[model samples]
Structures are given as structure tokens and as C-alpha cells.
Target: METSIPPPKRLKMLDATIKRHQYQQDALIEILHRASELFGYLELDLLLYIAHSLKLPPSRVYGVATFYHLFSLAPKGVHNCVVCIGTACYVKGAQVILTCLEKSIQIRAGETTPDGQISLTTARCLGACGIAPAVVFDGTVLGHQNPELVSERIQGWLQNGTN
Candidate 1:
């Protein structure tokens, strides 16, 4: 089941921007980005708010969101881990690494931990394919990962209050 997320004050600011621009259709992506930045992810209500304020259909807004890989529909945890699965990383066993992470964290891809400590996800590429099997934690990239090493690193981070 999905939980309700209150509309953040940032949505009001986005609304103003949309209105100021006379609700330009071209601004949809920017508006959605701003909303995601404010709320951590695009909640359903927030998407509807943007659609209503911009006079666009919610389906169009959702399509734009899903078309781009950056937008997340679910709430993110305090620490976000994005593992790259591009061709370079995949050949280096990135999929195995992700499975290990799921075992350790008990949450599958795109799911947050029960304690809200971490969210695990996969990306097509982090643009660091040279460093195959790359993983990003809170914007810091750690490349050339071994599955065992990745688990240890996550444990260390949680233990050290990095989460």
C-alpha cells in the first residue's frame, strides 16, 4: 500500500513559477524536477498538483517523469545507493552486487529499508563505466566494486553513523 505524502511548501513556490511563466507547456520538466527536489520524490498528489496548476494532464506529467530515469516515484531513504548497471558494469558482475545488497538490506531495487536508513536502486549508467561495477552512495561514487566489499562498506557506513 502507498502512503500519503503532504504537499510540501516547495510546491507552492513551483506553482508560482508556473503561473509567472503563464503555464508554459515547455516548463513541465523543470517544474517536475523542482518538485522532486523539494519532496525527495514525486508523490502522486504532488504530480497532480503540478498538473492542475500547469493545466496539463496528469498522464502527460507521469509520462515525462517515467521517460527520464532521474525522477523517482517512491520516497527515498536518508541514504540513497545507486548501482550502475551499464554494459561495462554489468560485465563486471554489477547484477550480483545488487543481489548481495538486497540480501543485506532486505529491500529490493527501488525500495527503502524499514528503518528508512537506506534506499537501493539501479541506474543504466552513472557515466563512470571505465570504473566498472560502480556504486554511488549519497552522490559519492565508489567504482570497481566487489560484492563482498560492497556489503562490508555498507555495514561500515551504517556503523559509523554515515547513514
Candidate 2:
């Protein structure tokens, strides 16, 4: 007979969050936010757990998780790079900056590097239009960016290592 291992403490915390929300279906987004906070990313098993707990269909749970860009189905790397491609940033050559990163890192947008050192993604708008062609490196918003500067920053992360 196989013994069952108890779920992680985070799972229990998620349960508390669900309970706090009274399991109302409308609170699905809030529940998911807490789940993601407890877990770095939303694993399939966790989503299923939430669905079962809320008495929601698995499809609905999956749909909500995928619908929002804020949630990540997969784990993120130690360092994260999010580029703003909103009208202001795009018009200022955000695409060129993104392309430079892809070529240098050999990974497309919304993908993490093979070694998991960095995860690259794009945001529709960071609300920093004044600084067009903006990129967020490790949560720090950078403005007036260029391919050379972005490349240099990434190279620095690769060489110096990120926390």
C-alpha cells in the first residue's frame, strides 16, 4: 500500500483563502491571485484543487487562468524581463528592443530561457507612456531604451547572475 503525502502548507493557506471568500464563484479571480501568491505559479493540481473546492467546472477554472496575463501557468525564472508594447512604447521602437532580446537570449516572448536564468514577456501597457520604449527589468521600469542598452543589461545579468 502506498502512503499519501500531505499537501504543502501553501495548499492549506490557499484553502483558507477560499474559505475566506466563502467559495463564491465570483471570487474566482481573487482566489486565483492568492493561489498564485502562495505558489510561484499555478500548477495544474492546484487549479484542480481550487475548482473542486469552489464546485466549479475545470474548464471555467482553466479558462480564467489562461485568460489573464498576470497569471503564469509555468514557473518564472530568477530574473524577469517584461517589455511594454503599448502604443507609446511600440511607436518608440519597443519591437526592436524585444527582437534584440529574443536573438540574444534565443527565446521568444512569453518564454523563459532554457537554463531558467531569465523569463521574457511583454505587457500591453505599463502606464508609463511618458517613457516610450520602456522595459521592466526585474520590476524596475526603464525608459528611453535601445537595443544596445537592453542587450548590455541582459548580458550583465548573464555574467553577474541575478538574485
Candidate 3:
């Protein structure tokens, strides 16, 4: 789908930060961080804006964004669930866990719910292998997940925001 790419806007606060840092190339990371915070995700226009302001190439900005797993090109969900697909989690049946979640939530990886309440995705590793079959809701990690428990927990989050 071809979405409209809006023109870039100059963010005064980010401009000031860039100025304070003397527009150092190293400051790109910091600038992108602030931009992500302001806009929720690193949209293409925002990337172009940063590139123009910093006199950097759009490709360079995109490269840095993609290099970091924390940066997302798409809009984030109000609620997010990240299941770990690391070897440990996989061995513990994380695939089954993810399948149950997909069925219950009715959204696949890299997609948000129709109401935009949740986005589901899988991570290569969360570095918490001791707790295999782990899923992270928002930023909180839930370990040792079973299918029923995963469904119930997601439902609870939708209904009560307990997660």
C-alpha cells in the first residue's frame, strides 16, 4: 500500500539540541531518539527532516534506524506483545504460544489490532533464556507461558489494563 509521505517539519526543540551538540554526526543517534519520542515512530518524513537538518543523507538516517531493534518504522500499538523466538523459548514451544496469541488477538506479526489496541511481534531473543517461552506485554516480561494463560492474559490486558 502506498501511503502519503508528508513533508518534513522542523522541530524547534530538536533543532536546539542539535545546535547544542554542534551538529556532530554522533548526535544523529540522540536526535533520532528524540524524534522517535516526539512522533512515536520514525516515519519517513521525520527521517528526511532529520537528514536535512543534520546535512546527512536519508539513507544514513535509515541505516541507523534499522540497525537498532528499538527503532520501529511503523506506528506502535497502544499495547504490544513481543514473544521471544530465541532457541530456548523456541524449544519450550514459543511457536505454539505465538499461534495461540495470533488466534486470540486476530492479528499477525507486524500488525496491530483493528482498534489499534495491540501490536504483535516476535523477537529473536529477549536475553532472558532462563525463562523460556517468554512474552513481553508492553515492556513487562511474562515467562513460562502456556496457550490458555497467554490468551487469558491478553484478554485481561484488553479488558482491565492489568498488564
Candidate 4:
């Protein structure tokens, strides 16, 4: 069974974080970052509360949160696999790696595994063009990635805690 924090507790924590930052409207991005870090994702209620506390329009808050790729409104898994899909990475066959991973885990990109063990996401770029086709697995950037290598890494991460 997974231990989870209640919604009210999460809201309180976010409120505290906002208060600590003085609830400045200009601190919206930072507030969202802290919220996502604490709750794993920003739910609708949290978004609304943030907008209300900031004295900003909900649309503005939502737009800012959605405009940035760093903020996630969906739940993430314990492990995250982010494949770079930049021009260099694409030229190096990043899509092949993504497809292979999807086949391996039976979950497409932007989705989490059924067991909630892993999540697969794609990035515009990981800023590793020299070592193109980089994939960030659990925050570790592995460049020069290929389908076979990515598959092996995924399998290893599944069988072991980390790789």
C-alpha cells in the first residue's frame, strides 16, 4: 500500500510555502515549482488556491503553469524516463528508443506504468547535442542512447532499484 498525504495537508503545506515566499504574484513560477516538488504534481484545487492567494487571475496562473514544461499537472511515478526529442536526438533515432521503451513497459510516452513504478516523458532537448539521443532516467542523463541500450537500462532499473 502507498502512503499518501491528504489534500488538506498538501494545501496547508503549499500555503506555508506561499507564505514563506510572501505570496508575491511575481513568485508564481517559484511557488508552482515548490508545489510540484512537494506534491509530485499540481492538482486543480492547488492551482485555484495558488491563483487566489496570489491575487492573480486563474487563467494567468494556469497559462503560466502550462506554458512551462517544468510544471506537471499529472501524477508522476517513482521513476521517470525522459527521452530527448530534439533535432539532434531525433536524427540519432530517439523515437526508436521511445518506441522500444513503450513496447518494453507496455505504456506509451506521457503515461505511467500500470504498477506506478515508472513514467515515460519526452523532452524537446536535454542540451546534450554532442552526445545526442540522450535519455534522462531517474535524473541521470545517458547520452548516445540507442534502442537496445535504453531497453537494457529500463530492464535493469526494473529488476534493480537503480542502474
Candidate that would win on lDDT = 2
lDDT of 4: 0.85
TM for every model, in the order presented, reads 0.87, 0.89, 0.80, 0.85
Residue-level lDDT tens digits of model 1 in 1-163: 1224445456576677788778998899888887777677888888888888888999999899876767889877778888898999999999999999999889998888887778898998889988888999788999989888889878976787654
Candidate achieving higher lDDT, 3 or 4: 4
lDDT of each: 0.83, 0.89, 0.82, 0.85
Which 10 residues in a row give candidate 4 its minimum summed lDDT?
A: 1-10
> Deviation in angstroms for 95 in model 2?
1.1
Q: Model 2, range 1-163, lDDT digits (tens) per residue?
A: 0114234777787889999999999999999998888787888998999999999999999999987767888888889999999999999999999999999999999888989899998988989999888999988999999999999999999998874
Point out the worst 10-residue segment of candidate 2 by lDDT: 1-10
Taking every candidate in turn, the Cα RMSD to the unseen true structure, in Å, is 3.7, 4.4, 4.9, 2.7
The backbone clash count of each candidate, in order, is 0, 0, 0, 0
Q: Please identify model 4 stretches exceeding 4 Å from their true place.
A: 1-9, 161-163
lDDT: which is higher, 1 or 2?
A: 2
lDDT of 1 at 67: 68
The numbered model that scores best in TM-score is 2
Worst 10 residues of 1 by lDDT: 1-10
Clash list (residue pairs), candidate 3: none
